[model samples]
Target: MGTMAALVFALLAVNILLGSYTVTIPDFFAMLGGKTIPGASFIVMENKLPQALLGMLAGASFGVAGAVFQTMLRNPLASPDIIGISYGASATAVAAVVLFGVRGAGVSVAAIIGALLVALVITALARRRGGTGLILIGIGAAAFMQAVVTFLMSRADVSNAQELMVWLTGSLNSANWERVGLLTIALVVLAPFVAVGSRELRGLSLGGDTAAGLGFNVPRARLLLTILGVLLAALPTAAAGPIAFVAFLSGPIAKRLNGGAASLPLSGLVGAAIVLAAHFVAVNAIPGTSLPVGVVTGALGAPFLLWLLIYTNRANQGG
Candidate 1:
């Protein structure tokens, strides 16, 4: 825990110091302490800081939500991105930006609605069949959503296409203090609900029959946790577009770090670290490119996904 905390803080500090243009550590500290150094304040405050903070929030939310979903579903592939939640959010957000010229809060609301609708469909489908069926259905739904998003992009004007392109890649460049505040409030409120429900979540992991036998209201608990997970995931997706794989990666990383401990708190911290580190690298290391942090994550996560699939197949064969 101490090591993880130190790493997280170190990454945060590094992210602050590095951006599109480099800044010396002393100058970065001075600007943070309110000393104006032409371009320093704008770079730190307006650009790098908000991007770092939003990256942390976005990563942490996805990590926690992904952990919840994976635990509840008992499947490693159960992530917001894989299960259609992120796609749903992104599709609606892109539509709002391209079709309606809406931005900010309006986009957030649309994303939330889209995520909820997708989740509802997933839940309804899952309930009708079974757990495995739900995973298959989710995959199909996600493919359909991606096709729709591609079609929408094709129909957009060049400028709109450019904007949607950046957005679709999941950049945090447009974040401001307003987005930071919204995400912070959402995290503060939603995190406690997850913590409070931890015991039930643990019980749910043991299977519905076992949880019910142990005096838990299995269905209600499942519903509550699902809602909590959706809100955690949806808020960040709205705030920062659909980041590629923080949710998908964090839980497994945490589990490995903790030697297979239940990966809630640790996953959240890992999520923050991954996002902050990626953002730091994207901003500082990449120079004038203005690369999306999500691109960095996607580059890393795609391989991890391949490995996971291989591991799952091998494990099934062994069983």
Candidate 2:
């Protein structure tokens, strides 16, 4: 945990201190302290810093969402990105843009509402069919939502399609103080529920009957966590399009780091680190070609997904 937190801070510092337009440590401090350095100042304050901060906040949210989903379902593959939740947001946001011509925060609002609506449906299915069923159902829902997004994109006007494509790819290029402020409000609202969830998650990890035997309301706990996870994911997807795989990868990575246990807070830290590092690489990876952060995470996640599938299969066979 300590190591991961340090890495998050270090990546943040690098993003601020070393970028296209470099600023010395002192000059950066001076800018904060009521002085400006012309070209460097605008880039740092307006562009780079906002992206970096958004990366951390949005990443942490993704991490928590992933951790909650994975823990609640007891499946490594169960994440908002892999399930229908994120697609619900993306699909709604795209429809809002392409169909209704909504812009800015209106799109985000649509995304959040869409996510909750999808989650509510998925939860109903889970209640009837059980955990493994939940995963299968979620994957199917994801594919369905993806199809909706694709159809909308295909029919969208060129101008709207262009914007939609950029958002779908998930870039931090649009990061700004306004988004940062909204996400901070979201975090503040959700943090207490997350803290309260720690115990519920621990109980649920022991299995449903056991948790129930211990006086935990298993169904209620699951629903609460699911709602919490959805909001965590939806807000980030709204702020920055679905940055692929951070939500999918953060939990397993944190679990590994935690010696096969899960920690929501730790997952959040790992998530922040992943986004920060990925943003750096996205900007610097190909020099003149700055790819979207999602592209990088998507590339990284494909192999990890393959490995996890194989590993999980082997373990089940060995068992």
Candidate 3:
């Protein structure tokens, strides 16, 4: 609990300090309180503050969702990003923006539908096999979705294409209080359900038969968790357009940090830290450009994925 609180505080502080423009902590706080500090007000109020808030929420949501999926499947590779949920969300959102002329809440709804569809497909394909088979099928679905996104990009007009490209890469540059509010509502409403189900989740880790023997409704519990996980992934992807690998890495990283607590709250905090840290680095590290936060995370996450695969292989061979 102490570590999670400290990490959250540090992430909030870092996000406030490091942006395209600079502001002292005091002035930033003052502006946030509506104290109109001349030139600093717009930078702090209109831009950086909202972006930071959204980034933290989005990151935390992705992290929690990833942890839930991994725990439910008893597979480290089970994540929305890995299982094609993010791609589904992104593709649907892009299609809405380009073809249906949708935005705001409508886009989010579309993205959710897309994510559910892809999840259903993956589930169907993997029904006959185990967790490993599910993961392989998910990977294939993700590849196909990515191909569709690329094709859409190729056909878009230049101006729209530029915007779509930025969104496709995943960015928080356009984040505002509205996005923050939406995510907050989601977290408040859904997070508790996940929290309440922690015991059932732990039972699941022991395998379906064991869980059933222990008087848990394994299928019903799994369904509920899947819904929760999908909402967590889909909401953030709708808000931020698939901000790569925060979901994929947060669970394992948190487990490593906390010596495997298996607590969703702890994992969620670590996820917030990873996302906030990455966004801070992206905005500050590149002065003029302010590269997409997703790019930074993806670059880091891709390598981590490779390491995980190698580690898993070695563990399998050793056993």
Candidate 4:
């Protein structure tokens, strides 16, 4: 965990201090001390710092949401992005932006609503169907919400289409202090609820019957975790449009690093590292072109998804 946190911090420093337009370590410190370095200060203050900060907070949010959902459900496939929660939130935000001109809190509320509604429906349908069924249903819901989002984009005006396309692709290009503040506020508010439910996540991971046997309120715990995960996932999606597979990949990566033991905090650090590193690569990988961070994470996630599926299959067969 300490190593992961250190990695995250190192990446955070690298992201802020070194970008396409590099800021010398001395200039970075000088800027922090209120000394202006022309051509460097504005870029760091307005462009790099906020982008890196928001990406960190948003990545942490995704990490916690994914870890909780996966642990609670005892399924690696049950990530928010995979199971429709991210898509639902994205669909709402896209609609709010394109169809209603909603911004700020309005888009957030819509996203939360969309995620919760989709989560509830999926949970209700898959109540008795086990984790595999839950994921199957979630995939279907994600497809449906994605279709809705596409329809909205298609019907939107050209300007809205352009904006929607950019947001959906998940770039930190438009990061600002206001967005950083909003995302920070979200994490602060959601932390207590998530903390209250955190202890229960491990107990729940042991299975419904085992959890109940151990005095854990299985149904209540599930609902609480579900709601907390939805909020965690939605808040970030509202700010960064889901950012692809950070959530899906973080928990498993953290668990593997921890010798197959789960750690939510470590998972969060890994998520932040993934985002910080991905953003850095996206901006610097090709000169004069800044690809969306989602594209990079998607590239990283696709192969992992395949490997995970194959591993799961082989494990089941061997068992």
Q: How accurate locally, in lDDT, is each candidate?
A: 0.84, 0.90, 0.85, 0.90
The alpha-carbon RMSD values of the candidates against the true structure, listed in the order shown, are: 1.8, 1.3, 1.5, 1.3
Off by over 4 Å in 3: 18-20
Off by over 4 Å in 4: none
Instruction: Score every model by TM-score.
Output: 0.94, 0.97, 0.96, 0.97
- 263 Cα displacement, candidate 4 (Å): 1.1
Better of 2 and 3 by lDDT: 2
* Ranking of candidates on lDDT, top first: 2, 4, 3, 1
- Model 2 pairs in collision: none
Cα-lDDT of candidate 3: 0.85
Better structure of 1 and 2 per lDDT = 2
> What are the clash counts of all predictions, listed in order?
0, 0, 0, 0
Candidates 1 and 4, the one with greater lDDT: 4
lDDT of 2 by residue, 112-229 (tens): 9999998988878877787778788888999999999999999999988887787798889889999999999989999999999988998898889999999999989987998899
The regions of model 1 sitting more than 4 angstroms off are 24-26
User: Best by lDDT, which number?
Assistant: 2
Q: Report the Cα lDDT for residue 158, model 3.
A: 90
TM-score of 2: 0.97
Angstrom error of the Cα, residue 279, model 1: value is 1.8
